[model samples]
Target: MRESEYAESRADFVHQLRIAIKEANETQYWLELLHQADYINKKVLNQLIKTVLKS
Candidate 1:
């Protein structure tokens, strides 16, 4: 995700941003799954969700 900040061109920036957003979405899905399965606490899940979507 940090790579997008230093992208050399607009195309590269967009590409990196898209990849980061996709990965963040995937992470959110997994986190939701874990929370639903009782693998993580609500507080922790909320924190993770906030961090993942902070951009």
Candidate 2:
């Protein structure tokens, strides 16, 4: 293969890799946010239970 063709192919590969990495990072962020929200909800529920028991 020609040098220019090889370089273009390599550039395309790099671009695709960058896009994949970005998508993976975004997915991880969403998962972490979901986990944090779940934890907060549990804490709120516990607080509500404690308040009710004290009443």
Candidate 3:
């Protein structure tokens, strides 16, 4: 292959790598947020149950 073709391929590879990394990071962020939200929801539900039982 030619030097120019190699350079273009390298550039494309880097671009795709960056996009993949961005997507992975975003996915991790969402997963973490979901876990935290679920935890909070459980805690709230437990408190609600306790309050109802006391009433």
Candidate 4:
């Protein structure tokens, strides 16, 4: 995420932001999958999901 801060151009900053968003979405997906598979409990899932969304 901090990569965007060091972007050399506005275009690069936007590109970095896009990459961050994509990664965040992927993290959320995995969290959901883990929750469904019972690898994580509701509390942990909620905490992680909240953190990801907040990012």
- Candidate number of the best TM-score: 4
Model 1 segments more than 4 A misplaced: none
Weakest 10 consecutive residues of candidate 1 by summed lDDT: 46-55
TM-score of each model, paired residue for residue: 0.85, 0.55, 0.54, 0.92
Encode model 1's per-residue lDDT on 1-53: one tens digit a residue: 89999999999999999999999999999999999999999999999999999
Cα-based lDDT at residue 49, candidate 1: 97
Give the winner by lDDT: 2 or 4. 4
Score candidate 2 by TM-score against the native: 0.55
Q: Please state the error at residue 20 of candidate 3 in Å.
A: 0.1
lDDT of 3 at 22: 67
lDDT tens per residue, model 3, 1-55? 1223344577876776666566656655555565577854655655654553343
* Model 3: colliding residue pairs: none
For candidate 4, write residues 1-55 as lDDT tens digits.
Answer: 8899999999999999999999999999999999999999989999999999888
| lDDT, candidate 2, 1-55, per-residue tens | 1223344577876776666566656655555565577854655655654553343
Q: After superposition, how far is residue 2 of candidate 4 from its true place, in Å?
A: 0.6
- Candidate 1 vs candidate 3: the TM-score winner is 1
Candidate 2 accuracy as lDDT = 0.55
> RMSD in Å for candidate 1, one decimal?
1.3
